[model samples]
Target: MNQLDQLKKYSTVVADTGNVELIKKFSTQDATTNPSLILNAIKLPKYKNLLLKSIEYAKKKNINLKETVSLASNKISVDIGTKILNFIPGRVSTEVDSRLSFNKNLCIFHAKEIIRMYEENGIKRNRILIKLASTWESIQAAKELEKENINCNLTLLFSFAQAKACAQSGVFLISPFVGRIYDWHINKYNLDSINIENDPGVKSVKKIFNFYKKYSYKTIIMAASFRNINQILELSGCDYLTISPTLLSELKSNFNKIDKKLNFTIKNKTYKNKITEEEFRFEHNEDIMATEKLSEGIRQFGYDQKKIEDIIIKNI
Candidate 1:
């Protein structure tokens, strides 16, 4: 079996792209998409129709440009997610607008709207994971949403505190970024490169995995933002790993023996204390890498969100 097939034995492989066509080529169990990915996918010739459809939906709403842009953005995300769901048997993660990451009510409202759109298309809520940023507000929002049976994937996660908070909030999943963590450390220490075994990103995921297993937290850890095939190989036994099409292709071409790097048989001591909001903020603030990367990630996604809105305006 190829490395991709071999890795699936231990962890669920997810396609981290908005391009449904590329996702169809891979044997991914789930698909994840952010504003940036949605923007890129809509730019492709094949996905142009999705954009046109979004524009048409916006025009029917007859709202102002601001409201229209917001409506179209959610429409496109759900439209693409709906398309992806046809190819994969598992759920599709459609991200909330990063611009609303700090607003709990807005986040919840948008998430529900996205869910409603999916349901209107005959997709069940159980087959969808609403993606939100790992901000405190977003985490709280997810907690309430979960109560209503709306599963969420807390994303842009980079700190142990963020992971702990998400787990305690009873979120369905958390995507701890690997490549962004590695990139921050590389530039911080001015290192030429780090070995795969010693990669900071990989180590972060391992730590979270072990912690979750030790305390028996039901929240799933889906490692994201991998920079290389080796990083994916390093996280062979995570709950899930969302990989780009480029890395997915690389894994499909390579046939190598892989082993489970993480398991539930953790030997670490368990902790029963819940993470307070203040403690979570302080701990995450202390980690310079997480602090900077989280902000940077939000900004980048926000920029892409604007780009998508711009395209909608042009079509209007």
Candidate 2:
């Protein structure tokens, strides 16, 4: 079997895209999307008609063009999310506004709104995970949502403290970004290529995996934003992995023998290297790499979101 199939034997593989076509082709177990991916998809020629239809849909409802655009933009995301969930036979993550990353009540309200939209279209809550950032406020937001039994995916994790915080808060899942970590280290050291093993990104997930497995935390770890197939291979036994289309295609072609990189049964499990949340914040703050990357990540996604919103309004 190819490595993708083999990896599935150990961990769930998720498509990391907003493109419904790719999700259908790979048939990933779950799928993830952010503002960037959605913005990227709208540029495709095939989606032009979708934009026009959204405008028309707005007109018939006596809604202004802007409202039509807003409705259509949301519809495109959910429409594709629904498709991915269908093909994958599992959950599909749809994100809330990143600007509300710090407001727990607003996050909960928006999450409920998104869920209501999904349910209105006949999509069940069990198959949808509301994606939120890992800010302290968002963590609190997730805690509340979990009580309502609405699952969540904590994105933009960079430090172990963030991981522990999410687990302690009792979130359903967390996506530790792998590629972004590697990027930080590469740019820090001015390295050209990053190895699958010993890569900082790989190490971050390993740290979280070992911690979660050791404590038997109910919150799942799904490594995201991988830069290469090797990193994906290194994380073969994670709870789940969200991979981009290029790496998925590469993994699809490679039929290498696989071995479990990290698992729950290992002895001598505790790493005394742990630190306090304040310490983690200071450490991450001191590490120019993590700080810069975190800011860049939020900016990049926020930028795309604004761009998409602009296009929607422009047509209105």
Candidate 3:
């Protein structure tokens, strides 16, 4: 069997793209999209209809140009998410705006608005996972949303403290970014040669995985932001892997035997006591790599969102 097929035996593969057509080609069980991916997708000629459709809705409501652009910017995500649902059997993750990541109330409000937009188009809430950055506010928002029966996918996660907070908050899923973590260490140490076996990113996910299993936490660990297939292969038995189409293609073409590198079995294990909010903040602040990467990821997403809005504003 091909590596893709073999990997599927151990994990649920999720397409990490805004392009539904590419997702269809891979037969990914689920799909995830963020402001960055949606921004990139809108520039493509094929996804041009989503923009035009949003504009049409704004016009029909007699909204002004500024309002039209804002509405279109928000609606475009739902339009694409609705389209993606037609191809995949499982859930589609739609992210809340990164600008709202630090504001718990705003995050909750926008998350509800995104879900409302999806529901307006006949898609059910269960088919969607609201993506949020793993900030204290966002995790708190996720806790409230979960109480209302809304599942969330916590993204931009790096540190074990972030993972611990999410699990304690009863988050539905947490995406520990493997490639971004690896990138931070790779550049920091300026290493000439590296061992994939002892990859820092892989070890981070394994640590979280062991903690989850040892304590029997229900939050699913989906490794994201992979730089190479080796990172993905090493994390073969993770709960879910949201892989890019580029790497998916690489795995599809390579017919190699993939092994399950992670196992979740209970042993004589002990985990740290659940952390307080102050402790969570202090630990996250201390991890320079996590602090820098988390901030950078949010800024990049916010930048792409502005770019997408600029494009819509131009048409308006």
The candidate that achieves the highest TM-score relative to the unseen native structure: 1
Task: Give the poorly placed runs of model 2, Cα more than 4 Å off.
Answer: 49-73, 266-287
**How does each model score on TM-score?**
0.97, 0.88, 0.95
Whose TM-score is higher: candidate 2's or candidate 3's? Answer: 3
Alpha carbon lDDT of residue 253, candidate 3? Answer: 98
Tens-digit lDDT track of model 2 for 1-316? 9888888888999999988889987878899988888788778887777766655655677776655655566666666576566677899998876767878898898788778767877999999999988877888899899998899999988877778878887899999998998887877789997766579888989988888878767899999988778888888889999989998888889988888776777454444554555765676677565577666766776777678778767766
**Which ten residues in a row are the worst by lDDT in model 3?**
264-273
**What lDDT is reached at residue 163 by model 2?**
86
Residue pairs in candidate 2 whose N, alpha carbon or C atoms collide under 3 angstroms: none
Cα lDDT tens digits, model 1, 1-316, are 9999999999999999988789999969999999999999888888778888988887798888898889988999999999999999999999999989999999999999999999999999999999999999999999999998999999999999999999889999999999999998899999989999789999999999988988878899999999999999888899999999999999999997888877677555657788998999999999989999989999999999999999888887
Worst 10 residues of 2 by lDDT: 266-275
Considering every candidate listed, which one attains the maximal lDDT? 1
lDDT of 3 by residue, 126-205 (tens): 99999999999999999999998889999999999999999999999999998898888889999764589878888999
